[model samples]
Target: MEGKEQNRQEGIPLQFCKNKTKRRDKSFNVYIKTFGCQMNKYDSEILEGLLKTRGFTLTPHIEYADIALFNTCSVREHAERRVYGQVNMLSPQICSLGKSKRGDNYPNKRIIGVIGCMAQAHKEKIFDRLPQVDLVCGPQNLYNIPDYLEDIAKNNKRILAVDRRERPVDRENFSFRNKRRYLTAYVTIMEGCNNFCSYCIVPFVRGREVSRPPSLIIKEIEVLIKKGAKEVTLLGQNVNSYGRDFNNGYNFIQLLKDIDKMHELRRLRFITSHPKDASDEMFIAMSKLPTVCESLHLPIQSGSDKILKSMNRKYTREDYLRKVDILRKLIPEVSLTTDIIVGFPNETDEDFAETIDIMKRVQFDTAYIFKYSPRPYTQAARLEDNVPKKVKEERHQELLRLQKNITLSNNKKLINRKVGVLVESADEKGDYLIGRSRTDKVVIFKGPKELIGKIVEVRIIDASLANLKGEWIRL
Candidate 1:
């Protein structure tokens, strides 16, 4: 099961926020380092726009940049720790660059900032220990770029713009810069999560779900498609919960049907669906919609009903299998993937076996297995995380080993089959191009650069547990 990004938005920049300075000025280079899900990746794109509008030039190398910003995550403690280590490693280098400037042509002083979920979760604490950090802003305050900078200049060495009480909705006018390199684009349908699962800090850090207007969503998709995007992945913490709180009763399934009805778009996909909200309507739309990918990344965190109850996942083991049943019945060719947490507090041997049993029953095409980690303020943090760290480590490996054979068996069945792949980039051997089939399987094949941005047929000749090796079949 591939774990999907829990919180993010497709960032469009605001022309209204443009600063008076040279474009890509050598004096000011802003480099954004992103970690975590697709949402964070998309947010980096928006961050790029916000910075570009402010006359800051983007830099590929972090060492060369005057502003090193991290759009980070808080799903796992390790994710946050990596950010801390990175900032710590660069603090001295940033200071050195600031001091070593020879003249006006050398460069300006550097500032380190942490934005997005990790910023919301740690707030000033991320800056407290690392005094070199100039700014910390949450996902909702991304549009407050100018003011956050203003405060920093006014004798504020460290400033955090996280509002735990009231989520500041600083909406920006949408204008994308340096578009993602692919026919596929992740267009966010909503921001935040309401689930607040016991072991997760997403809801607290990212806030409740707020969907973009269906019109805005449609407009965004249309723009991406016009910009040579052939496929779109509707990203959200819980995508199936789309339109639940909106005035328009247009649900995720309805959105699929609407998008499918559109001409020119070759493929469509959505991710990280909660098991509960993947309703009959969404499944039905998936079954009927021509462009919707046959793959669904529905996360079933735990298999045992007792463990699920503890995790506050809202679905039992049987309930999850029912979803697979519905999807298989509706679209027999549909590929299924899932996320499994191998160890959670109080999980017994029986619970662990039940999870393995569930895996055997469903035979997910792929699965992402993670050992549970206690996140601060999450409900599970209060519970006794009595599962031994070593035991958790062992269980995680067991799940991974099992999943390897399961995935390989599934891939083996596809050898010599012809599938449509949307070429995104080249494979490990640059001579061949790499793309994903509508079933969301990664396929590699030889093709000209012109083959990109268009769906091409590939004949699978070789198979690996992770991806399919194939050759392009010209139509």
Candidate 2:
């Protein structure tokens, strides 16, 4: 997977189907399973759009589908393990034995594919491990999926397309699949990362930073807004590094200001801001923009300057603290969230203590703590994984317990306060509506189904570590 191969294997050019605008077909169903983060979810939507244009239906059940695609993540060893487990389970059930729904019996099997980051990272290794897979496509080469499927059906041969090319995105049609549209949408403003954090594999799989043209993004958001989408989250690896690839002075702040001017847009959000790129202008835009949500996800992988330096994070503990201060000062009621890695190579007790101390000071509303897993071809992988499993588990539990208390304390402060929530869905019993506040906290309250896509006011009455119970108020 690490070694580069020809852009296409076995003379398969990266291309889309000629008849992409054909009417949708009800027979062929594509069941997709997505793992990892919001970026993968957005990528799945892109796949849905591409398949839909070629007349395939999206199905929730895997039993009835003619094709199955696994959109994978390679961020953590746990994620990779889960994908392998699922694929292994699927091999005996659907590979080589099952017949296609079309009853052609030429191939005599359902088409199985491995796509996204994992496919890009592992390449032909997947074929060696899982012989039942018919197609493998990387994130950048998604547009070639339909054509590859056709070739597999015709030639009965395996196809692998993990070429690192500057592929163009079909923004006009592929922004969000029409069949599975949601009120809250995710639009990618940029792709890939430039920061090669020592412990991360994103740069290897996703390539360098490339910003989508501002006009295309604005156009896509306008379309989503017209389709009754009330909220939009811009997806990226590190959103703070958005426009660095461009020579023009236009950057992330300007992008937000332009998008904020849309009168119909109710709320806007973004994720995974790098601490090194945190800027005063960006915070100011978030503070003043009416449509931008007050929630921010800034990842500070470590608080120990020593560990931080080894991770190639480029920012120190003091630098992170200052950024947090600026954000709090600009948006006093802002909800802060972060990512923390507990076990790194050669982490000492003092390093772990620094992480605990910073968590206490920041009091993040939420934190995603992960036990470090050494990935192949990474700098950290070369170091001795000195921390034992028992110690890592202990540190991980300690962080979780501390964060639980902090989250409960923060939620308690919201009691008796009015917050605006965009109603997203309802519980199975239909007795309660679930939505998120501007601060990105889940708030559930009794409401009519008619209020699903609207932003309504809710007064917090009870608080919990997971969510808040609120009383509905008129918009």
Candidate 3:
């Protein structure tokens, strides 16, 4: 939208996703089309958090919104395709928004632009397909959002704000409410990855790991809590590798210790840990921190040492096993979760067997198994996409089948245990509510609406592959 329409408007544009009463008619409402991981979700939330300060409200549906943003992910191939599809789906809205105000367009034209990884990878190419896209921003270019929006308001031309390199700071300090209603939130402590794992493009696409100063992260977490956040998961491509980019002594463990001291935080967690950086000190810190959740999402992409080396995962099977042993020994009751990339080029059945072996051995409480999708411009793409599609599917199904058994077995063990559950919302019948334990297991039980915002104890009566049935116990 142009500066003129923005200036002439009596009230903000239409808000499809925002709470109407709180939104000004003169402001714009934005719906984010996020396609990626928890980190992308966090980044989108941060963008909305900033937008809230500028009198913008967030919408849940994109088709009818005043502004549309696509938070893209490039971890796998299909993920990027999905982002493009989202942009195409919104084309009519973009054109209509553009057509309505052509002579004196509000110019926000709903300002459809792509951001995050896809924007980081495809950059200007996105515009070639969707020229109506007013601004294209990347994960690291988050701070430039306001400026890009401002530039579009004036010039009415497309602007792209994407950079793979880490830019130290860009948080505009907006409170993200509804994190459980605003419950669990992922807080990005650092941006980008330094590890150029042969199978990954994160390093080239996201640039090197640049840790947000510990103080900046702490301040961000404080704001999230004030807005009613109960839990936070510190985010980075490699969380344990945080602070290595600097000479400062503050590391991931130190950050955890500091955040753990926050009086308002009920639980804390982190993810996408690299086995290479899963340092001893971090494990000790996790065991000691009272508020730290008894769970970790360390991704073991492959279990065969040969595949590990081929993937350039840095750590071998023995190394990863040692780290797992350390975590188990130190945090005895810690619930373990992981990511498994099922098929890589040249993965033999024996290699596949090794991964299955680890699944049985770790008995991971949860596993997100996926067949590998070759992403463009990654080192892995340089190699032949040798794993047959059928084989990849079979490997993926086999892993899931194994994980289902593992999860059910672990959940069965939780039966009869009274655990702390942070009540999220009422069940469909209004007869029950749902929440997660510190271990991040989903638990369901009968409860009053009043229990929605508080953590309560629930006695487990039954279990399932994906969730648990429980009875809320009055404290």
Give the top-scoring candidate (TM-score): 2
Give the top-scoring candidate (lDDT): 2
**TM-score, candidate number 2:** 0.92
68-114 per-residue lDDT for model 3 (tens digits) = 88888888888877877767766433322332223343332466768
Global Cα lDDT for candidate 3: 0.77
Q: Write the per-residue lDDT of candidate 1 for residues 1-475, one digit (tens) a residue.
A: 0111111112111111112233333345677899999988888887777667776677888866756888899998778889889988874334223322223332334667888898888775775577666777887777665456544433323556776443243333457434646467888888788888899898987889877777777887787777787898999999888888877677777777888877878889898899988887788888888888899998888889999999889988888888889889999878889988967999999999999999999999999888888998898999888999999999999999999999999998999899988888875667988889989899988888788667888999999987999988877
The order of the candidates by lDDT, greatest first, is: 2, 1, 3
Please give the RMSD to the true structure for each candidate, in Å: 7.1, 5.0, 5.3
Task: Give per-residue lDDT, candidate 3, residue 72.
Answer: 84
Candidate 1's TM-score = 0.89
> What TM-score, over all chains together, does every model reach?
0.89, 0.92, 0.88
The positional error of residue 195 in candidate 1, measured at the CA in angstroms, is 1.9
